[model samples]
Structure formats: C-alpha cells, structure tokens
Target chain A: MKTINTRRTIRKYSDKEVSDELLDRLLTEAARTQTMGNLQLYSVVVTRSMEGKERLAPAHFNQPMVTGAPVVLTICADYNRTSTWCRNRKAEPGYDNFLSFVNAATDALLYTQTFCNLAEEEGLGLCYLGTTVYMPQMIIDALNLPKLVMPVATITLGWPDEQPVLTDRLPTASFVHYETYHDYTPEDINLHYAAKEALEENRRFCEINNKETLAQIFTDIRYTKKDNEAMSEGMMEALKKQGFL
Target chain B: MKTINTRRTIRKYSDKEVSDELLDRLLTEAARTQTMGNLQLYSVVVTRSMEGKERLAPAHFNQPMVTGAPVVLTICADYNRTSTWCRNRKAEPGYDNFLSFVNAATDALLYTQTFCNLAEEEGLGLCYLGTTVYMPQMIIDALNLPKLVMPVATITLGWPDEQPVLTDRLPTASFVHYETYHDYTPEDINLHYAAKEALEENRRFCEINNKETLAQIFTDIRYTKKDNEAMSEGMMEALKKQGFL
Candidate 1:
C-alpha cells in the first residue's frame, strides 16, 4: 500500500544507466502478471542504443524522455507467436480480427502496468507515452513491428533526476458508481471535482492560460478536438493495416 | 518486489464483505495513476449486492468468481464527465471517436490494475474477468452506462479462500526484444515454451482433450476463430452504438 499510494509518474531522469540485470530481474518477475487464458499475447522492445531511441522519438512526438531515459520499453500487443505455435502443432489459429486484437491489447496493457508497478518499486522513474497508439504506423516502421503486432504504449525508465509533488485526483465518488453506474448529474460533477478545481496548481494553470475555468485549459489547449480527430483517423488507418480493424 | 513477484490470480474468495471505506481509499489512491495528458478518462462501477452481481454475471458468462466475490468492479473507458467539463466551461469537445476510445480504455485499464495492486497489497485477493469486452453490451445495460462510457474489464475482489499456485510465463527472452520486435522462429518458440509444454498438468490437459499438443487446446476449444469473429462483429456494433466507432 505504501509503495503504490506514494507512486508518482517520473518524467525527469539522471544520467545513471539502468543495469541490464535489474531490468531482467524486474521483467522476469512481472511476467507473472495474469494474462488472457495464459496466452501471454504481448512483447517488449528495449531501446537503449542511441540510434534506436532517436529513430523512435518522433513516434512519441519526440518526447525528451525518449532520449533522456536509459531505456524505452515499447510494449506490443502481439499474437503472431501464439498463432505460430498453433500452426506448428497442426492446428488452425483464428486470432487475426478485432476481438483477437482486443484480447491481445488487454494482455499487453496488463503486462505493461504490472511492469511499471514493479519498476517503480525498484526505485526506477518512468513515464508512459500514450502517443504510441496515435502514431502507431511510425512505431511500426521504427521498431520493425510486423502484422498482428502493434505497440500499445511505451515507457521511459531511469533513476530520478528530480522530485515532483503528487498530483490530485477527483473525490472517490466522482469515479466510483454504486451497484450500477451512477450517471453524473451536473450537481454530482461539481461535488466530485470541487476539491481538485480548488487546488492551487489548477488555479495557476487556469490563470496561466487566461481561462475562466480550469477545464478550459483542457478543452481549449491541452486536448483539442482537431488534434484528437486527426490522431483518431490516423489510428483507424493504422489499425486497418495492422489487420485489427 | 517480493509481493508483486509472487502474486497469483485468486478466483476463490471468502464471503468477507469488503468495507466501503477501504474500497474508496484504494481507488482514490489509484486515480493518481498517470493518464493521457492527465485527462483521467475513466470510471468504475462497484457491485456488492447479490442482485447487482447476478445482473453482471451473464455478461461474464456467469463465472463463479462473479457470484462468489464480495465485490465486483466494472472499470470503464469514460469521457462523458470530461466532455461535460468542456461544455460547462464553454469549450467544444470532440472525444466521441475511436482514438479517444483507445486513450480512455488505456486510462481505465491502468486505473484498474493499480487498484488491484493496492488491493492485493492490503491482503485482499482478486481475479480479472476477460469476458468484459466480449459481452460489453450486456455490461453496458446492466451497469446503466451512458454514452462515452464502456466497460473495459471487471475484477472480482474478496478475501482469499484459496491460495492458487503461481502460473508460469514464457521466458523473458521470447517476449523481450532489443531495438525491434523479434519475430518468433519455430525453434525459438520451442525453446521458450518447452517447460510449459512438458508440464504434467499441461500434458494431462492434452490427453484429456485428446489433443496432439497444448496449442491445439487453444485453437480448437479455448479461443476458436468462429467465436472470435462473432464476438468481434458484435463488439464493433456495440462500439458504434456507444459513439466510439
């Protein structure tokens, strides 16, 4: 509970290298994370070399952490290996569609988060790159990912360079529904988000953006519709090519 | 590391009811999990009543854990609240699409896993239901989920009544590549899964099913192509109705 409750997303990293042995130890242990029917439909590409990081940076929109961290782990939703196993054993495999993709993606994400939890516990700093899905085509090319495999997300890892304060979350009520989903009424939304909106950092962000409400900073600047749609279209096309669509 | 390393999936749970306060505390702590651009696009439905679990059980194919566990959490890929924030703050929102769905699903999964980790650390046991996506429409209606909200997965939680032994995983080398995805060769597959295939339990499973190999068990029975395609079609239709397609 202590390790999990105090965990923070780490963006900055020192120059110290993460030893291969440590990476192996954490990963081998995290491999115990529960998977779909125990198929283990996921893979990871560890990027430590200069060329690998440089090539993969643009896929994450050139996030500095890509190059700064000693390792960038590209977690892939992969089913090729399992399909190969079936074929080798004289059985036909049918995991090439959207449902199969969903299953594999689920496996990949569970594996990714478990690894992150263990890595954080080992004193490693890390950041998740959600950009991996939006520009998956770029990742596919950069990482030579074949059909039936896609990078779900990437994480940059190293020793921490700085300490950042923990971020605030909405009151538990905002997110947790009772026996059934409690749809948010306007009043419920306000009640749930009151403390977060009242935070000093949120107020500062609103002021910095010259916005009346902190949420405007999100809608008008942080996550615009234009960017989201453009990325969405690209994602659909990539999903098609990867044979998930 | 020790805790996470030895963690196993728990399907059998004692009838001890989880307190509401404990659930709230763990969830509140878990919401600090990093999200896409801090958008925190997820919500969870907590089911503790027998009626609630029974309603959701069919969606999970009535897995015994669904009815046995004291609590069932349906974690959702949510955007309604965030979009509401945008509109209330006088900003246009464009998250009713597939790209946004991916982001929110990623957020929801991370949140659920973090909560599971904390719950496990607090000496509770849990198992994730992969059936959430297969019958999402039933889950949507059962949970009264609104548009822009879809169940990503369900996890059953309770005090453990059984201590399941740890499951095995593929060798780290089979899944971990350097610089790029390392496609599996037949020899590599054999080398990686040799111990698993040679296990007495697996060999017994093959013999019981009259299968030539362990892989045949999956292809022929566990995850057949016929079921996958049927489920994928249904899922696409459901996603479209939910405004994500």
Candidate 2:
C-alpha cells in the first residue's frame, strides 16, 4: 500500500538533488528484476549533468521535464553485448529475427518499470518520455550509442515542485476479462470514450499548469501528431545499417 | 528497499484457495504501478478452476508450475477497449499502429511486474512462462481472446514447494554500458558463453527441460527452434484480417 499510494507523476520539479546513494539503490532494485535468460539485455544511462540533459532535451521535443528534473535516465536495448559473446564463442549471432528484437526491447522496458517503482517508493516523481522512439537517431547520436543499442525511453526524476493531481482511470471492467476477449459495440464505445474524454477534461494534471482539460488541449495539439514519421520510417533502414535486422 | 526486498517469485502452493477479497486487493495493487497518461491499456485474466489450469498447462508446454501454482494469471494487451471508445465518439479506431501495440504490450508487462512484486511481498513465488508468444493462436483461441486483444505472458503463482538456489547473473560488465554501446570483443563472448553454459548445467527448472548451458539452451530451444514460426508469420496476417496492420 505504501509503495503503490506514494507513486505519482511529478512533472513539476524544484532544484532538488537526488543523492548518489539513492541512485545506486534504485539501479540495484532495477537489476533484481528478471531478464531474458539472465542475459540482462539492457543498460541504464544516468545523466545529472546539465550538458547531458541539454543534449537529450531537443530529442524529446524540448520537454521541460528533461532539463528541470534533477536526474535523467535513458533505458537502452543492447544486443551488442550478446553479439560479442557469440563472436567469442565462434558462433553466428542469432539476432536476425524480429522476435529477438522485441524480446530485448520488452526486457529493457520491464527493467525501466522496476526502476520507476523503486524511485517512486523513495518519494521521487518521474515522467517517462515516450517520444524517444521518434528521435532514436538523435538520441543514439547524442548519447554515442553503438550498433545494436537503441534508446527506448527517457525518464526524468526530481522532487515534486507542484502537486500533480491523480488522473482518472477507465473502469476495471473496461479492460479486464474473465476468459476471453469481449467485443465492444457502438454503445460500449460511447460509454468508454465519453468517460475517457470527461476524465481527460477533468483530470487535475493540467491544473498544476493552470490549463483546461487535456482532451481540449489535445484538440489544439494532436498528441498523435506525426512529428517524427520520417525518422520512424527510417528505423528499418537504420536497423539494416546496424546489421541487426 | 522495503517493497523491493519483499519481492520473491512463488511457485509452490499450499492448496489453499485465494478468497475474492484477497484477489481484489491483489489486483488493485497490480494496477497501481502502471504507466501514466492513465491509458491503462492492459488486462488481467485470472484462471482459478482446475479445468482452466488443465487447459493452460499444455499451452505453456505442459509446465508443472501451471498446475502447481494456486493462481495462473495471463496478462494481455487490450486495444479492443480503446477502439470501442473511438467508435463511440464517431471516430476512426486507429489503435492499429505498431507503436500502440508496443505501448500496450509494455504496459501489460509492467503491470505484470508490479503484480508479481506484490505477490512476492505476500510470500508467493512465481514462474513466468515466456512461451506465450510461441502459441499465440492456440492460447488466443483457447482463452477466447477477441480481436485486438493478445496475451503477452502468463505467470503461475503459489507458495514454494522447493527452495531453488538463487540464480547467478552474468558479470554486470557483460550487459551494462556506461554511456553508449560498448564494443564486446571475442574474448567477452567466450567468457560469458562459457559461464552461462556452466550455470545451466546445474540448474533444474523442470522435468524434461532442455537443460543445457545458457548459450546452448537459448540457441537450441529459443533461437533455432523451428516449431512456431507460423504463429508470428501469421500474426501480421491476423492483424491484417482484423483490420489492424
């Protein structure tokens, strides 16, 4: 209960310092989570230096959270380590399949979640930058990422500068199923979407910034706007260039 | 340290039934550590009956853990819920993007971690069945999975019948990178692969297991195994059929 209740996305941050001890403990906790075959196919890049944060900010659409947060960590999917291992053993590296790529990416994300939970338990607020995928090349170049390594997400950590109100949730029934998938009819769509739009509007998260509902805000700024379609489209080519696909 | 240190996967069972109240509390905790945007794009499928266990056993390659554990939960990505909301708003349901699929899948896996941690803190051991992807069609059909809903992974939870030795991890250097993807030389691979093989030889996960070293096990069992290529190959086709891809 303590762990769950203490968690909140603190987008607003003061000039607070996250101690090294806390970061170490957080990484250790993240390390304890399961990895595929214990290969541990990911790495966390911690950045507290202003220069590093500056380099990352543009890639994340200049999201203020990146520069404002006391600590920023990038979780990366890394197949380079395993590839090296395969080479040493005189065997071909088996990263040709899309399955391997997905597995490694998922493993990296799982590790990120564990780290996020650990940080939250320590009273730290974090906001995950989901836009990293759109700017993978920028992040890779700025972070000097090598072949077979990709930045999946960036997480900003800092003490809460403002209290962000909790967002509303879709009813558990909307998602959970007993034995199988439940098809949604038009009525079901209306009910769920109406609830979602209302929640987005009423959500207190925007209140911290003294704004209207996110739904209305999204009307002006499409959240799914194609800001980086060209880059993501080039991802397959990038993977081929890296000899990973 | 508290929430994290308390986590342990439980596989052994006491034949004790989990009450509805307890299950509710557990699910609530499971839902707590989810991703923000409050999209909550995941679901939990709880299988309690012996018959359900019987069905799940074969789906998970007849793993004894499914039958032994008191609870078997399958975590799934649910686009159906979000699509319904779109339709109700007289909007096109575009939950078919690969990005959305990855997001929901990540959310489901993250939720699984939270639930697994909660269960462990409650003194339950867990065994995660990674075979979910290999038999997607069979599992989906058996679980009555609807369109736009797919299983990510299945976990079996219960008290421990045996005290398995703590598994050793590959040297941290083998996986963790400081700033970028580090060059893994041939020596690194040989050392790591040799170590991984040695560890697998002594570990006993279950009867009739592949039981090879990490390198051999993954190579023979996961990478080279050719039984289930059709499922993944057919996945794109299925998505196309469902108007997803």
Candidate 3:
C-alpha cells in the first residue's frame, strides 16, 4: 500500500548503474503478469551500450530519458518467437491480423507495467516513451525486429536523480462510472476538470505558451491533430511491414 | 514479487461482496501508474449488478466469469472528458486519430495492470477478458459509452473459489534480446519449446482436441484465421464509431 501510494514517473536518473541480475529478477516477475492463453506475446530488447541508446533515441524523438537512463527496454508485440515454435512442432500458426496485433499489444503492455512496478519496488525509477508506437518503423530498424514482431512501447529505467512532484489526476468520481457509463454533461465535464485547469502549474504553462487555455498548448503545440494523423498513418505502415495488417 | 509469483486467473469466485472502500483504494493505486503527457486518457465502468453483467456477458462470448465475479470493470480509452475540457477552455482539441487512440489505450492498460496487481496483493483474484476488443460494439451499447470513449479491455474480480493451476510460458531467452531482436532459427525454436511440447498435459490436449500439434488447436480451432479476420473488422468499425479513426 505504501509503495502504491508513493509511485511517480521519474524522468531524470542518477549515475548509478542498474545490475543485470536485478533486471533479470524484475523481468521474471514481469513474465508472471496475466497473459492471453499464457502465450506471453511480447519481448524486450535491452539497450545498455551508448551506441545502442543513440541508435534507438531518435525513434523516440530524441527524448532525453532515452539516453539518460542506464537501460532502454523496448517492449514488442511479438509472435515471431511463438510462430517459430509452433512451426517447429508441426503446428500451423495464424496470428497475422489486427485482432492478433491487439492481443500481442495487450500482452506487451501488461508485461511492461508489471516490469515498471517491480523496478520501482526495487528502488529504481522509470519513464515510458509513447513514441514507440508512433514511429514504430524507425524502432523496427533500430532494434532489428523481424516479421511478426513490432515495437509497441518502450521504457527507460535507473535510480532517480530527482524527486519530481506527483502529477494530478481526475477525481475518482470523474472516471468511475457505476453499472454503466454515465455520459458527461457539459456541467459534469466542467466539474471534473475544474481543479486541473485551475492548478498554478497549468496556469503558468498556459501563460508561458502564450495560449489562452491549458489545452491550446496541447492542441496547438504538443499533440496537434496534424501530427497525430501523420503518426497514425506511419504506425499503420509499420504494422503492415511487420505483417500484422 | 510474492504477489506476482503466486498470481493466477480466477474464473470461479466465492460468494463474497467487494466493498466500495476497497475498490476505491485499488483504483487510487491504478491512477498512480504512468500517463501520457499527464493526461489520464481513460475511465472505467464498474458493474456489480447481475443484470449489468448479463448484458455484458455476450460481448465476452458469454464467458462464465462475466457473470460469476462480484465485480466487473470495463476499462476504456476515453478522450471525451479531456476534449471537453479543452473545448470549454477555448482550445481546439483534436484527438480523433489512431495515435491518440494508442496513447489512450496504453494509459488504460497500464492502469488496469496496476489495479490487478494491487487487488492480488489484497487477496482478490481476477481474469482479463480479451473478447472486449473483438466485440467492442456490443460492449459500447451495453455500457452506454459516449463518443470518444471506447472499451479496450474488461476484467472480472472477486475472492477465489478455485485455485487453478498456473499456466506455462516461453523461456525468457526466447523473448529477451540484447541490443537487437535475435530472430530464431529452426534449431533455436525447437530448443526453446522442447519442454512445453514434451509435457504430458500438452500431449493429452493435442490428442483430445484431435489435433496433431498444440499450435493446430490454436490455428484450426481456438483462434482461427477466419474468426480473427471477422473480429478484426468489427474492432475497426468500433474504432471509427468511437471517433478514434
């Protein structure tokens, strides 16, 4: 309970190196997370060398954590390994489709979260890079991923250098609907996001960006529709090249 | 680590009610998981009523766990609340794209995994329903989810009624790669899956299913190519209707 309550996403890391033994233990725990048919349709690529980090960093739009953390782990939605196993056993495997992609991706994400929690429990900090899906083609080339294997998410991990403030969240009421989804009225929306919009940090951000509202900074600058569309198209292409279309 | 190691999917549940207070604690822990850009793009619909579960059961192919558990959580990738907040603040929000869907889905998944782990620590058992994505439209209608909110996953939770055997998994070396993915040779594949294939349980399953190999059971029956294609199309349609295309 104490560990759950104090969790935070740490971006900056200390110089202390994460041991291979610790990583292996954490990974073993991660593999224990629930999986579909116990197939465990995921894999991790460990980038420890400077050259490896440099190669993979651009795929994440050069996020500082890509290079700053002691380890960069790329979590992939993988069927290649399983497919090969089945083929060798005289079983024909057919996992090349969108449904399969979702299955593999779900397996990947669950394993990733379990690994993150275990890492935190072991006194290490971590950051997830969402760019893995957006620019997956680049990641595939960087990681040498083959057919039936696609990068879905990535994480950088090490000891923390800074104690960043825990970020805010919507009130539990705002998200926890009873029995069924309770569609938000305009009033409900206002009530739910009121505290977040009024935060001093958000106010500073809006003003600093010369935007009239906090969301303008997001739409106009950060995750604009134009960029989202392009990235989505790129992801589709990557999925096709990886034979999951 | 203990919590993870001993975890198993519990399909049968004891006739015990889950308290609201305990559910709240688990959710709070879930909200602490990492988010994309600090925008928590997810919500959950909690179902405790028998009628509600019955309505949701068909979407999961009438899986007994759907109605058997005391609590069912339908986790969604939601952009509605955040988009409304942006629009109300005089900022144009544009998250109607695949990249945004990926972001929201990732956020929802991490939160779900955290909640599951926390619940296990508190002595509850759970099972994830992958059928949620395959038949999302039925879930959308059943849950009354509005635009910009899509059910990405579902889980049933309660105290255990059965202690199911833990399932098997591929070796860690089969998935983990150093710096790059190590595509498996036929020999590598055989070396990796030998134990699983030699298991008496798997051999019995192959014979009982009238399949020559275990993978034949997956491809020819459980996860057939035809079913995968049909379901993938259904999911794509749901994605468009949810405004995440």
User: Per-prediction DockQ scores?
Assistant: 0.78, 0.40, 0.80
Tens-place lDDT per residue, model 1, B12-96, is 9886878988988888888878898777899999898899999999998888999899999999999988888777667788888
Q: What is model 1's C-alpha RMSD?
A: 1.3
After superposition, the stretches of candidate 1 with alpha carbons farther than 4 Å from their true spots are none
Compare the candidates by DockQ and give the number of the best one.
3
- How many clashes (backbone atoms < 3 Å, residues ≥3 apart in a chain or on different chains) does model 1 have? 0
Choose 1 or 2, whichever is better by DockQ: 1
> Which wins on TM-score, candidate 1 or candidate 2?
1
What are the clashing pairs of model 3? Answer: none
The TM-scores of all predictions, comma-separated, are 0.97, 0.85, 0.98
lDDT of 1 by residue, A83-185 (tens): 8888888889998899998899988998888888888888888999988988889999999988889889899999999888877767777788898877777
Q: If the candidates were sorted by their TM-score against the true structure, best first, what order would they fall in?
A: 3, 1, 2
Error of 1 at A117 (Å): 1.1
Q: In candidate 1, how many Å is residue B25 off?
A: 1.7
Say which candidate scores most in lDDT. Answer: 3
RMSD of each: 1.3, 4.1, 1.2
Residues forming the 10-long window of minimal summed lDDT in candidate 2 chain A = A219-228
Query: Per DockQ, what order, best first?
Result: 3, 1, 2
Candidate 2 lDDT over residue span B1-245, tens digit each = 36454444455667777676766677776676656356677878888777888887887788788877777888887766665554444445545655566556777888887776666666667887777766666677777777777788788877666665555656545555554445667666666556555654435542246543444445556555243245456554544444344
